[model samples]
Target: MQNYKKDFPIFKNNPSLIFLDSTSSTQKPEYVIEWICDYLSQSYSNIHRGLYDIAINSEKMYFDSKQKVADFLGTHDLKEIIYTYNSNYALNIISQTLRLNKVLKTGDKVLVSIVEHHSNIVPWLILKEEIGIELEFVRVTQDFDIDFDDFEKKYDEKVKVIAFTHVSNVTGKIFDVERIGKLKRPDTLFIIDASQSFPHMKLDVPKMNCDFLFFTAHKVMADSWLGVIWGKRELLEKYKPIFSGWWAINEVKKECFKPGALPFKFEPGTPNISGALSLLKALEYIEKIGWYETVESIEKELIEYSLEQFRSRPYLQLIGNTESKKRVWVFWFYIQGVHALDIADAMAENNICIRAGHHCTEPFMNYLKLSSSARMSLYIYNSKDDIDAFFKILDTNFNPTWLTK
Candidate 1:
C-alpha cells in the first residue's frame, strides 16, 4: 500500500502530514495532473467546433474521456452520462429536468433522509418553493442508520422521488441502497448522492437500482470541479434542458434551432476538455490500483483500527456506528473537554488537517444536539500511522474551557 502512496505527489514531501478530510476534497495524483497538463499544452482546442486536425483530435479526446467515465460507472449507453460543473450542479440539473417534465408538481412529494448533505437537500427545498411540491424527510436511528420502519410508513403514492446519500459525509454511515431500491414505485424516482461512496467504495448504479445518480470527479482523485450525472434514458429523455445553450441543440436550422436528444440536451456549453482528460487518467489510476481491494484494506487496517482506539474511551463519543461494513472512513466524534474547531486547529498546527463544522448538514447537527463535530475522513493515501499521530495529539490535549462553552 505504501508503494501506492508514491503515485500521489501530495504525500511525497509531506510524510509527517495527516489528511483526513476526503469528504470535502482529495489530493490529486501525479498521473491526473500530468494528463491535464498534456491536454492543455498539446491537445488544446475547442471540441465539436471544426473539422481541422487539432479540433478533431481534441473532440476525440474529450468524448473518449466521457466514454471512459461511462465504462468506469458500468453504464451500457454512453448517452446516459451527463457532465456538470460539480455534484451540486448535477443535482440542480436533475431537479430542473424533473420540473420541466412535470414529474415534480404541487401535489408531489420528494423524500430524503435527515442526514443529506446540502447538495442533496437544498435543491429539493428550492423545487418545493418554486414548483409547490412537498418535501418529506426520513428519520435516522440513534446510531445514525436510517429508521427503515419509519421510512416504510412514510412510503406512499404522493412521493414522486426519493434521494439520499450513499454515505454520510460526517457520520460516515453507509446506507443500504438495496433496501431503498426495493421501495421504488412506478412514479417514484430513486437518486443516490454518491459523492462520498463512489470515490472509495465499489459502485454499480444498475445493481444499486437508482434512477438518477451523480458524483464529483475530484472526490474520487479525478479532475477538479468536474462531475458525472447518471440517469435512466427514459426519464432524462422527457426533460428539456432549463439552461440550454446553442451547444445543446442538434443544429441551428435556416429557420430555427432544435434541441439534441438525451445526454447532449443536458450539456449546455463549451466543455472542460482538460478536466475530462484528467478524469480519464484518474479512472485509469483507480483501475490500476484495484478500487475494491484498496477500499477493503483501508477499512480493515485504518478505519477499524481508529475506531478500536477510541471505542471504549469514556470522555470521547463516536457519532456513528463503528462497524466497518456499515460505514466508510468519513467518521466524526467529540471529546468532552474539547471544541471541535479547537481540536481541528491543534491538529493543523501539527500539520494534521481534519474538518470541523456542521459539515453542511445543519439539520442533522440540530437533531444530534451538537453545534459541531470534528471529522477524520480517510482516503487511499492515509496510513495507520496517520491515525496514530492524530489520536496522540488528542490524548495530549485537555482544555477545560471547551466543556464550559
Candidate 2:
C-alpha cells in the first residue's frame, strides 16, 4: 500500500530478494543510513569528554537526539530516557538494581506472560535464583491473546512487580497495557518490553503508566541498535546505578557521595551516540510517513488475507491470534512433514528471507507442541505482490525432494 521499499538501499542492492522478517530487525531507510554515515565521517568524536568544539558539537547532537526522542514519545523530560546497547542491556540494568529496592524483597512475587521474549523473562528468573523471589506466568488464551483471567489470578499484593510485552514478537498480538497496568497492586511496579510495539505504534509513558519501558533501535529501522529505556523520573532519581563508571559521578569532594541524576545515574559509560542519533532519524521517518493507524490498516488487511490462506491450506497449521483485530502483521506457522529449518533453506534459494526457530520463546513453543515454526513479519514496505511471491515459492518449490529425501 504505502510502498516505501525505494527508500531502503537493501532492496536496490539485492533486487530479487524478498525480506519478511521485520520483527527481528527492519531494513534501514536511506535517510537513517545517510545520517549515521555523515555523523561518523564528518563529526565523529566522544561526547561529553572534551572542551573542544568538535566534542562539544558531538555532545550537543547526542543530547539533542535524546530530547528529540523524548519529544517524539510525548514527553519533555529528558531525564526519563537512558541509552544502552540494546533492549537486553536496558532491561538487565533494571533487573540488576530494582529488586534491591525496599519494595521487592526476597519471597515477593513477580508476574510475566507466556508470550514474553527471553529478554523479558530471563532477568526475572535470574532474580528468582539469586534472591529467592517467586515468579509466575499469565497464560495465553486459545485465540492467542493474553488470558486476563489468568493474569488477575496471578496478580495480587504479594506480587511486587509485573513485566510483559506490549506486542508479542511471534504472535504480534497487541496487549492492553492500560488494562494490565490498572490491575497492578498499589505498590507493585509494572515494566513493559515494547520492542515489537514501539516499531508499529505510538507509546507515551504517562498513558502506559508503566514504571519502566524499553525498546531496541534496530527493530525500528535503525541499524546497530542501542536501546531506549524510559522510567518514571522520580523512580529513576531514587534508583541506584547497578554498574559503576567514571561518567556516573555526581560529586568529587572527599566524604561527599551521591549517584548522578536520572539518566546519567543509569547510563554509566560512553554511550551509543551514533545508534541513538540514527534512531532519532528513524523516528522522523515514521512521523513523515504518518501515524500508526495507516500502518495498522495495511497490516490488518495483509494479516487477514494471510490467515485466510493459511487456514485453507490443509497441510499447514497456523499459530497466533485467530482474529485480525488482536494481531498485527506477524504470523507463525508450520507445514506438515516440513522441517522449519529446511523450509527456510529452500526459501533462501528462492531469494526469500524468513526466520524459522523457536525464536527464543521456547517455553511457549513447548506449550504448543511445536519445536519450531517459520515466521513472517511485515512492514509498510511489504505489499500483496510480496505475499504472492512468498506463497508462490512455497507452493511450487518449497522443499525439493533432494533435501526432503
Candidate 3:
C-alpha cells in the first residue's frame, strides 16, 4: 500500500492531508497531468478542422482515445463510445435522444432506483414531464441497496427504459446490473450510470448487459471536463441529438451537413482531444499498475477499514452495508448529534476532506429522510492511514461554531 501511494502525486506530496471525497472527483496522478501537458504543448492543434500535420495527428489521437475507452469498457465497436463534457451530459444525451426518438412516449414508463444521484434522476424527470412519460422509482432495501425482488415485482411491459446507477455515490451500494437487466422485459432498454463503479471496480458494459453507460474521466483519475458514453451502435444510430453543436459535422462538410455517423453524431462539438489522450494515459496507468489489485487493496485497507471504524460509533448512522456480493467499498454516514456540514467542516479543519451534502440526489436524500450526509468515499490512491486520520478527527466531534473564534 505504501508503494501504491507513490503512483498518485497528491498522496506523495500531501501525505498529511487525508482526502476522502473521491466520490466527488479524484485527484489526477502525475502521469495523467504530464500526458495532457505533453499533448497540449507539443501536439497542440484543432482536430479534423486544420489541414496541417499536427491536426492529422490530433485527430488520430482523439479517435484513438475513443477506441481506448471502448476497449476499457469491453466493447470492440469504437463507434459506440461517444465523447461528452461529463457524465451528466452523457446521461442527458441518452435521455433526450431516447425521448426525441419516441422510445420514451406518453404512455411509456421509465424505471429508476431510489438510490440514484441527481445526475441519474433529473434528466428522466424532465423528459417524463415533457413527453408525459410515466417515471417511477424502484424501492431500495433497508440497507440502501436496490431491491431486486421489488424491482422484479414493479417491472412490467409498459416500462421502456430502466436507468439506474451501477453504484450509489452516497451509499456505496453496488447494483447488480446483469441481474437488473435480466429482470427487465426484453423490449425495455437498460441504462447504467457507471460514474461510481468505473473508478472503483472492474466493469464491462456488455457483461453488465446494459444498453447505455456513462462515466467521467475526472472521477476516474483522468483529465477534467471529459467523459465517455457507451451505447449500442444501433441505438446510437437511431437516437437523435437534442443538443447539437457545429463541430458535430466537421468531417462531413462535403456531405451537405448530414449528421456524422454513430459517435460523432452524439459528440457534437470540438472534442477534448488533449483531455481524451490524457484519459488514455490515465487508463493505461490504471491497467499497468493492475486495476484489480488496486481496487481490492483499496477496498481492504480504506473502504472496509473505514466502515469498520464507524460501525461501533453510537452517534453515527451508516448506510449501505449489505450481505450481497455487489457492494464496492464506498460508504455514507451521518453523525447523530452533529450536522453533516458541521462534521465535514470539522474534518476539513483537521486536514481531512470529506463530502457533505445531498450529493446531488436530493430525492434519494429525501427518501432516506435526510437532507444531507457526511460521505467518506475511497479509491485506489486512498489508504488505511487516511481512514484512521478521518476517524480520529471525527472522534473529536468539534463544533463548527468554535471555528469562528
Candidate 4:
C-alpha cells in the first residue's frame, strides 16, 4: 500500500513523530495548511453585517465554503448546514433549542446508545435535569456492538428523540444507523453523532434519513474547534434562538426576538471564518487523496497486520471486536500490570503519540467494567511501520517484526 506520509508537513519538520492518535485529531495536510495561511494573509475580515470589499469577500468565502460542505456531504439542501465551535456545541444547541422552543417537552424520553462519546451523553443528561426529559440508553453487547434488542425494547410512544453515535471512537464498531433509523416512531426524531464515522466513511443524509447529524472538523483531518450540524430544514426552522443579540432581531420596538433563517438563528455571534475555510480545504484535500475507499482499504490492511502482531503479545489485551472486519483501524487495550498512562508515556518517550484513559466515553468504559485503556488509532497517513514501531516501543525485549528494507 502507498503511504502518503509526505503530504503532511509536520513529518518534514518533526521527522520522528509517529502520530497514532488520529481518532483524537489528525495532522493537517500541506494543502489545508497552505490554504489557511493564504486565506488569513490575503483576506482577514469579519463575515456579513458589513458591505466593504474585505467583508463582502470574507462573507462570500464563508458562504461558498458552506455550499462546498453541503456538496461534499452529498446533501440536497445547503440551508440545513449550521457551523458551530465543535460537535459538543452542536449537540448542546440541538438539545437546548428543542427544549427552549418547547418542541421536546417534559416527560419525553430520548434513547441514546451506551457506546456514545460524552458529548452525546452530557447534553441529554442536562436536558433531563433542566427540562425533566427522561433519558434512556441502548446497551452494548459483549463484543462492543450496540444491542439492537435493547434499543428496540427502549423505544416507546414517549420517546421523542433517538440519539446515537454512528461509530464508537473507542471500539471502532460502526453502528447500523439505517436499521436504527427504521425504528423511529411517527414523532420520533433521530439525532446522529457522526464525529467518528464522518472522517472515515461516506454518508448520505437522505439515505440515512436522520433529522439531525453532528460532526467536528478536527477528527476529519482539519483544525480544531469547528463543528457541523446537519438538520432537516424543518427541524432547524423550529429552533428557538438561545442567544438573542444583534442577530436575533424581530421587532423594532422593544427587540422581542423571533428566530432568523435556517442556520444563523442557531449560530449567532461572530463566526469562525478561518475554521470554515480550512475545513473546506480539508474536504478538498481528502477528495484529492481519493476519499474513503482508498483510505479505508489502506487502513484496513494496516490494522489486519497490526492485529496479527498484537495477538502475539502476551501482556497486551485487545478490547472489543478482535476481527478486523467488525471494526476500523482503532485498537484499544490494557497491558497486564502496566498502567495505561505508563504505556502512553513510554510511547511518548519513543516519540509516538497515542491516547490513553476513558477517551471521553466513560459510560462505555463503565459498561465494559474497565477503569481505563490505551488506544492506537490509524488514518490515511499511517503505515505498517508505524504499528510496528508502536509494538516495538511496548516491549522491553524488542524483536524485529519489520522488513529491514
Number of the predicted model whose lDDT against the real structure is largest: 4
Residue 184 accuracy (lDDT) in model 1: 82
* Model 2 ranges with Cα > 4 A deviation: 253-257, 398-405
Error of 3 at 189 (Å): 0.9
**Clashes found in each candidate (C-alpha, N, C closer than 3 A):** 0, 0, 0, 0
On residues 99-149, what C-alpha lDDT tens digit does candidate 1 reach at each position? 887878887999999999988988989988898888888999988899999
lDDT of 2 by residue, 1-405 (tens): 567889899899999879998998899999999988998999888876798887998888778778877886777778888888889987888887787665567999889898888998888889889888898988988877789988888887789888989999998889999888777666888999989988887787677778988889898888675988888888887877777566777776676666776667777778878887898788888878776776777877788888777676666677877678867788888887788998788888888889999997987888888887999878877888888888777777543443376
lDDT of candidates 1 onward, in order = 0.82, 0.82, 0.79, 0.84
Model 4 alpha-carbon miss at residue 354, Å: 0.7
Off by over 4 Å in 4: 248-252, 397-405
- lDDT by residue for model 4 (148-256), tens: 8888788988899999989889889988888877777668899999998888888877777799998999987778888999888876776666665455454445645
Off by over 4 Å in 3: 12-15, 243-247, 250-256, 322-325, 398-405
Model 3: colliding residue pairs? none
Measured on C-alpha atoms, candidate 3 has an lDDT of 0.79
TM-score of 1: 0.94
**Every model's TM-score:** 0.94, 0.94, 0.92, 0.94
